[model samples]
Target: MSARLEVADIFRRHGEAYRQAHHGHLGRVERRVMSAIELCRTAALGGHIEECRACGAVRVAYNSCRNRHCPKCQTAVARDWLAARASELLPVPYFHVVFTLPAEIAAVAFQNKAVVYTILFRTAAETLRTIAADPRHLGAEIGLIAVLHSWGQTLTYHPHLHCIVPGGGPSPDGSRWISCRPGFFLAVRVLSRLFRRLFLEALRVAFEAGGLQFFGSIADLAGPAAFARLLAAARRRDWVVYAKPPFGGPEQVLAYLGRYTHRVAIANSRLVSLADGKVTFRWRDYRHGRKTKLMTLKADEFIRRFLLHTLPDGFHRIRHYGFLANGRRVARLASCRQLLAVRAPETAFRAEPVTDLPSLTHPCPCCGSPMITLAVWHHGQAPPPRSAWNDSS
Candidate 1:
């Protein structure tokens, strides 16, 4: 009932019960995620001590688990990632596009995350490259940054990829930049068709290669005939590929990336309450004019929903492709800037170094003076008690 509520609070209180209830079905990644979130920023992980120079006020700070799924650990990580991406922006217009899998395919993806998700990323990227490369469309090689998200507003499993792309790219001959029409980026209908066909074909190949696994309710899909039927049904419907209008400029693109790049299923700020075996949070209803709404679920159900989004270990959720692919990014970017006759942004993109000591940049609450690190401690070691410090001073 405190003013400060977190997913950690819910996990610490009810996670064990959920784990025991689902022991037969719980996964290693999900179990680790729950443990990491529950122990994050607690004495169990240990941390450091800081003191105010002006007033001699001291405080203890705990270490973060730094797990990607922890809501408490993503802010600084996202900031650093955005900083690295700052210099990569171009002066031209940028567009936002989304590729979504249908519910039937999404169900299979939920069962086999790594293979299906990888296929989704590759097929989505290929769809754009294939369509944009055609002489009829933009006639230029393009680049994009794609981020994968597995949850919808209410924490439902809805796998999709959000892509940020420049308005155009260097010509196939490496001669010059080719921009699209003033407001348009690409044809969604064309993109949707290709994405559907490519994804189904890739899924078929993966199934044939024994790269996919089906279980429980969907176990029947293990058969070639059943799997063929699933794909055939998916083919009958149009896949969703949406492209928003071009951004006002590069600045808007950076802002959008900040919100999405390191996001978790739900943020701590959205939490409303945890009481009486229920957890409440805020969500938006996109189907009904984006209306704001609140959802409350049993504490156990909340934990289950949160764990549905644990990514496979070592999986990279964010990726670059085409001219922005990791290997070609630098040279291609320099060439694009030269062709456009534009200089890189005035601000330099430098990554701050990691440090264990508390930063002196934060002002002390007691004296309004800088706080300096007084001591450092590692896991399993506790700093001196407050009483001991006060007595010594």
Candidate 2:
């Protein structure tokens, strides 16, 4: 019955002040994010009108910026994406794996977002596929849908990939389904080591190809020696690769994807208050068993923290690999389903009504007759202004 204090509210209240404080220092990404948040769901972008004919109800629907990083827009998009993906899930146990980069690599990823993030996906996928295909492991080509998350609860740059992989896969020989032992999936220790090596190797390749950029505090890392030292440090430390126990069934995987796939740094419901120029919100400390606690941050500081996750333009955070690889996904996935003895799903999930809009027809202003479209107006340019009669006439 009460209003929720959201990150948007904080941005609405103090985003300008924050911008002023960081003026001449804000990166392109952060500046664009500020503009998006302040103008989203406002009249600046124009809108559509929906009128209920039966009930005399009218609603003005504002346009969304449709920025993937915007919290308000991500939910509906996430839901639609989940619905499409739901049918691809096999009717078997699914495992959740997380591949995390060390803080050192996270620093590099912050600097070279598109390149490093792509490397993260490729390396993690390669590690999983290679390890899964080995005779010592499942010896089957597996499928995984990976989603990249760049922020932790407090909105710091913590790059990690979350993957949902089916517990079993078609055997390499194509004779049968290969199932792993119950309660165990891929070996995390092996995954961590392979992930480290592959990611570092890929990073070296990216650097050589001039696909990386360094700035600000990360400028020193542009040198090979410094980059090598960073890699060595990552290898010396334990890379975190965690595997959650098998999910119950296929439907559960749909629910899981709905939450994780398109999540932003924070959600609207988490905030409790915004008063006295301070924002208070609840966050779960995952390292401490999901303990919930309230944290208060100055309004400007809150926006600063929230802006830390503004991704590079057109950067794709989610990726598919192995059997789900782009080019061969259809064929490979069909073979997998046949071998697993599971038929493809009969119907896909639908989160909304498919027929929400009326067919296009111009209602005549004079007689209320429906006017069929004879031609389309191209480029939306107005017709040339008509010329008045000649002066001689």
Candidate 3:
């Protein structure tokens, strides 16, 4: 709740030593993440003075690190993303579907993050579109908003995709709308079976084509025999594909997006304390009735777990598919609104800035007066340039 219990506090106090100890093992991008978290919203990044127009109150506004991994800055990112998505909401019901990789696949994903993660997205989208159009299922072309989450409740490496789909879709012939049964979508068991088959088949193709990498503990899997064994074991197991009931309406879907989009591994609110070289934080023990518990780890270990979710540079965690595909979204959305007989936001209302917008950017903390920017504060160095996070070698 306070600065003492925030992630920045822990990083500021212990990050330098942790970086020094892990110098040889950590990548340049990982080190940059540590540096950004350590200096987030602090005097080190510089600050600007703002003066209240009515009361003459002066306030110093510190610059945010704006790193995607920084806990303090992701809130704004989530807000902006959700705001953009608000108008894209359809009048029909929405469903939440999840696609998860098994531990064996997750191990390979750890080494080949960009490749494996991209494969995961592609496989998931293909499975959904393929099954939903089989004539036995919905038989409509569904739209989905998929988000990639790589961490479990305790910050463990568990790669999964969270997909928000419409309950129905446009007909295959694009002649008319097709809607699923009320409060029901595709069957989860069928989805899981198809998803497992498609992903394993694609993984086999990537392996035979020399697209995947292996190293350290998994070096043996690079061989054809070892890789076949891996695939066989994965095939025998049931891949998890969880589907929840449809959301009540568009408002509920927007509320759900606020939580997952652009989220970091851990939030500042969960941190309880950092003392005696151990950082204590609240975590959910999902296996045990979802019990609330406290977990403490050494300073170095804490930082290590936190950095495990840092994505490869330019790797998009959130992806769109089917009707929501990025290239076709604008035209498809406009067509969908017309077909569904719903009005777009701009067409429904006049375009004027909301009255409450100013409170977000320029408001006096002391007096409720409008605060104006006094001067711009420039940092000593520019933010780190985007580069590849790891080398294949």
- Pick the TM-score winner: 1
Best by lDDT: 1
Task: Name every residue pair that clashes in candidate 3.
Answer: none
Worst 10 residues of 2 by lDDT: 384-393
Candidate 2: residue pairs that collide: none
Candidate 1 TM-score over all chains jointly: 0.95
Clash counts per candidate, in order, are: 0, 0, 0
Per-residue C-alpha lDDT of model 3 across residues 249-320, encoded as one tens digit per residue: 877888898888888999888988899999999999878999999999988888888888989988899999
Can you write out model 1's per-residue Cα lDDT over 1-393, one digit (the tens) per residue? 446899999999999999999999999999999999999998888876778878987777889999999999998999889887998999999999999999999999999999999999999999999999998999999999999999999998999999999999999998999999999989999999999999999999999999999899899999999999999999999999999988897678888998999999999999999999999999999999999999999999999899999999999999999999999898999999988989888545455766664456356988799787666667777766655443312
In the order shown, the candidates' Cα RMSDs to the true structure are 2.3, 6.8, 7.4
Candidate 3, residue 131: how far the Cα is off, in Å? 0.9
lDDT, residue 66, model 2:
79
Per-model TM-score versus the true fold: 0.95, 0.87, 0.91
Question: What is the clash count of model 3?
Answer: 0
Q: So what's the TM-score on candidate 3?
A: 0.91
